[model samples]
Target: MKKRLLALCATFFVAFSVPAFAQGTVISIEPGDGVQEALQEALILAEPGSVIELAAGRYDFTGPLSLDIANITVRGAGMNETVLSFTNQTTGSEGLLITAGGARIESLAVEDTPGDGIKAKGVDTVTFKDVRVEWTRGPHAENGAYGLYPVESKNVLIDGCVVKGASDAGIYVGQSQQIIVRNSRAELNVAGIEIENSYFADVYDNVATHNTGGILVFDLPNLPQMGGHSVKVFRNTVVANDTPNFAPPGNVVATVPMGTGIMIMANREVEVFENDLSDNASTNILLVAYPRDYNDPTYNPLPRAVYVHDNKHGRAGFAPDKAVKDIIAPITGLPVPQVVWDGAVDGFWSAFFGPDAEDAIYIREPMGTTFANLQMVKDMILPWGASPDFDIDDYDGSVPSREPVSLPQDQ
Candidate 1:
């Protein structure tokens, strides 16, 4: 009888404990003022694939919170109920930095960091959901550079988040591939959302308002990543980006005109469609060539293979900025067409007769929206001036439509 009882107890222990062990570890952090310290220790001690649960409370963190483990999840009670305030942050470039791939950070609010609010670097299969990163002090030049910054990462999904008050861009995705930034809202920043030097990005169903510039798809020079391409911006509300440019002087976004919406600069295979652009003073939508000098030989200065169609615009291009007020408006006059391009290209040969001689800017604006191509000949002379081409029919050629971004192993 004793042997039978011991055997039964052994069987029960194996049945329950084995399954519990296979379910992975759960590190529950107690609610306390030393939340940062406790969380840091948990990160250091927790095994891979562990779930770190943060209780509902305000966690004041001074330094940065980092995750270097793969397949780890840092989840909070809720974005509003559990707060990570960095208002008095003394050290770190970001509120939370995740370097490990296959990690998920969700349901947390990170506020008032000195630099970027949440930055994930070189990570694959990372998901950021229900996260709110904001600057409580409002828009200023000293605000963080980006609210949710992801660079050089692949298979990234940023969903259902709200970000505000970035000196540069509220949601900046750079050099990343297979990125989907959807169901998000950004406001009161320099560039509400920017996809720079990235490929295969799908940005849709987002609200971008009250920013310096609404949405930007740019390819800048001199970086580890160059030549952004294959971007799709659709079904988003990019409106009234009238906030003053608070970006630091040396940054690329500083040159972005205020009250501009959906600026695409020097990228290829871009499609902008089914979006609502309204009340932007400078221009509702701009497709311009990169004017700055670049050292990168592989970088394409002119935007090629871009398709813009079926977008709705409202009352844009009313008040112009300094660049427009000084150069474009002097020749084109006020309400500088809803869509304008510098028409700067590779000499008259390409502009008139070359492989890309066809107007690269394809505008099928169904609302009978007029557009202007400066054509780099204002006052009939060359160099700085341009004769404006205000006919919408001239830019009628269409490029091949690109496929949507495809990623493997997505959640």
Candidate 2:
């Protein structure tokens, strides 16, 4: 079977054609008996800068596939045409695990993985274009964690992708620098798109809906990277994110209230603007400090230097859920607000001295936009009941604008 597959690949090299600028060999693989062995062998034997082309068909695998050769391009016929089904996978965590630099995986779909659908870890210059990862069973706690996940990598570009039914996040980029996630759609996930503990990322031109949370920019504690900063999220359509949180218990995202459009937690120097947000029943946008107690002295739990401006909002917070419905709704009344900021600072000293000019929340929205500053810190210390500030004018032009993030991949 191996010899026959190799001969078939050679025949394909002669019969098929690649681009004129392709500097490497093209090894083609089609679905048939022993296809899992054929594809895995091709991936192992392929040299650097090779193009492993997969034909249009369903490829069944009982285990995971890994690509470790640098500068390899894995091209499929189309996202819907070439399906890699790991429904019966018995070993390995991810359907496809990529650890090589300069690897591009495009035009394919991975379905029904026990773990992550596709994961790129510790790679430099990786790109995922026109790919889709999904669970056929839809939203459930047993679904995979992430659809297209890139972690601890630099110079990442994820464009024209679709992800659904991820228990955690559909498109997640974490602990990476110089990243861009654009022209994507995510639905039926815990978080549609999440940029966590990353630096210099621009997430724009994406559609996020039907998830527990639409888009999240979070800086969590105790990681290889801390203090995530310099992110710009703009021009995204975030609406109707009313899916109940299906993450496993005790996960951080499990705390996310349903119907959250965009939530920013413990991130600095972030900007949110020009987004179309509507019908997100919890709130259109939430800016909050990290709610858990942490022992990391280096972690800054407050979100600072954040600016939100000129975002269209409609009919949000009308049907709040989870914490938003239980705790916040009683205080703020029905239709909680379009934007809610947990007024939490570092400590008593920072609260008494007032936040620095650069570490304030800035808001510039259209008229009739509702907002609230739930003075959580003040309520914790003082004896008075929650003094929720419902004014938006106090936060006008409070922080300096951030420069746009430019990536090497964009150039």
Candidate 3:
């Protein structure tokens, strides 16, 4: 698949001059004019290609602003110039929603929304430029849905944006193809950025931090279609974002890479390289096996065929338990020690592949063990920079009572 364009190219200049529709309409929403009135008027007068300009201030809408029009432009003075504050939107409403083709939103701020900050659905040729989507009301699982959500769409571009404080995810793309999300910041949300059930998508040069999991590429089961294939996650900074486990009791499974910085699950032929992921409470880099059957019904395990390479690990807090224990063989003729972690060499071509018994070293049929650069891998292995207490019975953190931690749903 051809890679989606990451940067705004000069080619757009050619397309920008195409004659616009609704030639006589110049709708302006300013501090003096009520935002609701401007929006109502824009809806009344807006044609296929109308431009509604907004001036700077905190403009609160009484309810959701649903744009069913096609090929319209809703722009603000500048990113910082005009602010549409939705702190008072008490209904479960989105700050801005577009349900059209060739729609564009630029230089605006949408925040404190009861639902997703900006939702664009079924829109082809949509572009969000220099926009900010945030949920500053505080991180509650019920509050933040998504900073920016593009679902079941095609030819979407989300660039130069900021998404934060989302209870669920900063930016979420689901059931979409030919998408591009670049030069964005996703932090302090449930899952920073998630791309699920998407094909031929490119997520590059983005910062994902201070969330439960940083970046996720996965395919969900039982969807109308099976997608999430051939994606690339590269050139991003994923850092210490593991707060307390928020996944509700009996709903989450504790894995070593539990609060992993980046997880590539159930996707085929994916490349993860050249990113700095560290200081997370769990494993810095993880290649997981799809959970077959687990205690949590909320998440389905589906990881397979991943290529993890070229990343750095950081400092450790404590020593994990390491003992050369016994193993048990499976009845289905599968070796017990399936997933292998080899930190002695580079991650790309390392010999410690999973589920093959010929690669076994000493202990045969071990139940499940974690090996890292820690001296314990041979004794009681822990990866470099990971605390021994990780995934163990004893775990503590900056905040402990956060519950119902759900990973960012990519689809």
Task: Summarize candidate 1's per-residue lDDT along 205-229 as a digit string, tens digits.
Answer: 9999999999999998888888888
Best by TM-score: 2
lDDT score for residue 182 of model 1:
90
lDDT by residue (tens digit), candidate 3, 173-253? 888877778898887777788887777677778988777677877666666535476566777888776644343333221
- Candidate 2 vs candidate 3, TM-score winner: 2
lDDT of each: 0.82, 0.89, 0.57
Each model's TM-score? 0.90, 0.95, 0.68
Instruction: Write out the backbone clash pairs for model 1.
Output: 376-386, 377-386, 377-387, 378-385, 378-386, 378-387
How do the residues 1-411 of candidate 2 rate in per-residue lDDT, one tens digit apiece?
667766756643422354521667888888776778888877788878788889999999999999899888898999999999999999989999999988888899999999999999999989898999999999999999999999999999999999999999999999999889999999999999999999999999999999999999999999989999999999999999989999997888999999999999999999999999999999999999988989999999889988999999998999998888987888789898999988888777655444677788888888989999887787788776557889999888845556666655456
Q: Best candidate, lDDT-wise?
A: 2
The C-alpha local distance difference test score for the whole of candidate 2 amounts to 0.89
Residue ranges of candidate 2 with Cα displaced over 4 Å: 2-4, 10-21, 349-354, 398-403
TM-score for candidate 1, residues paired by index: 0.90
